[model samples]
Target: MEFRQVSDLNFNISRVTLGTWAIGGWMWGGSDDQLAVGTVIEALEKGITTIDTAPVYGFGKSEKLVGQALQEFGNRDEIQLATKFGLEWDDEGNVQRNSTRERILKEVDDSLRRLQTDYIDIYQVHWPDLDTDFSETAETLQELLDSGKIRAIGVSNFSPEQMDEFQQTAPIHVCQPPYNLFERGIEKDVIPYCKENGITLLTYGALCRGLLSGKMSKDRTFNKGDMRRDADPKFQGETFDKHLEAVEKLKEYADKNFDKKVIHLAVRWILDKGIDSAIWGARKPEQVTFDNAFGWKFSHKQVKGVEEIVETIVEDPVSPAFMAPPE
Candidate 1:
């Protein structure tokens, strides 16, 4: 695995960070606790030093599993651990957005206990809390930083305006947003702002929820509990068809130019865009191996080919009006 220096934070992060959402067992179709723990160990053995998770993921189950895995390894300092807070899960399985000082403090303590670590390397706000003042959250995070509970601070799923608001109060070291060949909405604002402000872009949804992998068939139907089946726009009827058309073109390019699978080509295309790191949602250790080997370098021609192909079919990100509730 390759590593990149997030200049602002001065941490050397793996170019491909392991995402623990799938293992969280709340959104993904299949999850295995043993597999999740083994995958983290496997990733560490392969030199992957970054692991991203959230408190809401499995309602703290994910953090507990991660903690167990790290304890087994007995080398926590060798890795950079990142986890998030902000979203609250209710009894009805609904997520309530809250970033108030009291909520954040409670959540961080709970995460620390579950993670089995004294200080998190990177602590991120899962998403913006419009109902609360940004300063309130920022100040709370600053207190955590001052108290030595966290080394760096970040925000996930934040719009450009929200990012600016948080930055005005605190120095943000990283920003996690969904960016892929199919989702280029960040190009309009978020990406540029991060580049200009020296903030690292740690992108998720690099595979468009597995669409770019070319594994989903037109007849494929997700299980009832799978989150993507219900929420991801790219998996829906007409949108899925359009995305598949684009993936077919990408496959053609991959075959002719790289002699590699389309998934590798897809991941490499995003890496070539100057993203600091790509967080992959892997459920099994084998998936981590596949993603780790999915070529990080691309030739100039291959890069240009991806740009041309993506520009042909990519559309603006789904408007806020179309967004589904967060899982």
Candidate 2:
């Protein structure tokens, strides 16, 4: 329920952004339209006003559902819509990166129509398209900003070097990267880069695909088509067991120290590390709980303590590298 401001656009985004990737039903088996709308409403009612989605999410289904929810909510101005472009999928659902100028131009209008909004609060490139020149893509986003089609520009899964090249051509107001208690890769560069450059960090995967939810069990199973079954390395064998054990210790620590759960600790850890916002992915309405995570502060010592506990259990932790787009 807490909010943070982006210096560039003065946008007050909620600490918990409603991530609609699962609602898109692209990789997490499937989705229910009714449940999806209810999920958005639940998030908004719980003070999560920002929604992060993408065109390739169910190939526009997520955006359409979000548009429906907005219409039902009846106050478009209250919500901050954050969506992405630069990835295209085929009839068979194969995805590839494509950030050419023409692609961006086409994608924006489609996004507008799907979301039923003329202006997007924040528009981001889903991934870096090596085939396209960074300057060219930057120019296109700048044009969108100048034309009022998009209020701000951001990029996801981009390195510091890529961001430097992107900023040389256009201003970046935010950066989205995969970050959580388990995946600490961004701590090496992306976090510091955004912190120093005045760009807000909207980190996704705050739950580590339900691993940190404190509800996953050793006997749990995933849907046959679920991305966690194949795409995520953390869900495999010994790594999964190690992660679960770490979560158990984390839960105990949270309950003893702060009367919180592992999920709250996972999210608060990110916010405490200076991230502007964290995207919480969910498909069901009841799953959009934001109150428990906000208004809690983690001491530097406590943060270090949690890290040490995780280090003890997860000696060979893995990042969500499989979620990356094909090169």
Candidate 3:
């Protein structure tokens, strides 16, 4: 469990953060509370000190469960709690971007209550609200930081220009972008911007929502409520097959070269690309295995070889455009 210090933060966060989006059970069908609790405990035991969650994830259910697990673990100060706001949802699960000053103020209090923590280690804007002024959101976060409601401010799914605009009013210590073996969209601008600005990048979807986990199969089916069933185009028809083919080749390469699974390779790939941290999504205790993901990396030549393999296998690669919030 290697740790990296983010700008102006008190704790050195783990390289691998436990992502609770799946445990939220909103898009992945459903989740069991006991299983979620066990998964978090397993993560802490395995040296995962940072947990990334969002208010819209299962409509606060994920944060509540994480709070419960942290209470049982009884080590609030040792763990880094990373959560987000701005994405609002109603009873019908209709979501929209809302990052007004009032919304940010209200959401911080709600997140505190849900997470069972007075000060969030890092609080982020879940998405860019086109309707709201960036300064408005930045000023609100600055106020939160000044009042000690949050230790640091971060942003997710934001472009370099958007971040530049927001930074005029407040500081951004970190950036959360969806990054994985399949989702390389952020590498062009987001990654370079964070690197140049000294903002830590905590990338989510290390396994591409289980596609690179080496467990996906052609015949495997998703439940009705599962986001992969409809929301994710990677799991649909030919794109799914193309991704699976790439995963198969990547898995073979991993096993042959390093005696590691594709999941490990997927995670290591993110880290090797100079990301500050990779968020691993898990819903069960056994799924929290961190041994396979650490202690090794792909060589430069091997990295290019892996890219060649992906190019050879995935003819029509798809972006995760469907997961973006409403404008």
1-327 in candidate 3: lDDT tens per residue?
Answer: 888998766667999999999899998999999999999989998899999999888999999999989988978989999999999998899999999999988999998998888999999999999999999999999999999998889999999999999999999999998998787889889988998998999999898989988999999899879989978989989889889889999989999999999899989888898998999999999998766888888899989888889878876668877899789
Worst 10 residues of 1 by lDDT: 316-325
lDDT of 1 by residue, 55-171 (tens): 878888899999999999878887999999899988877887889999999999999899999999888998788889999999999999889899888998888889899978888
TM-score of every model? 0.92, 0.98, 0.98
For candidate 2, what is the total of clashing residue pairs?
Answer: 0
lDDT of each: 0.82, 0.91, 0.91
Tell me how far the alpha carbon of residue 162 in candidate 1 is from the true structure, in angstroms, after superposition.
1.6
Candidate 3 backbone overlaps, count: 0
Clashing residue pairs in candidate 2 are none
Q: Is candidate 1 or candidate 3 better by TM-score?
A: 3
Candidate 1 stretches with Cα past 4 Å from truth are 290-296, 299-301, 313-327
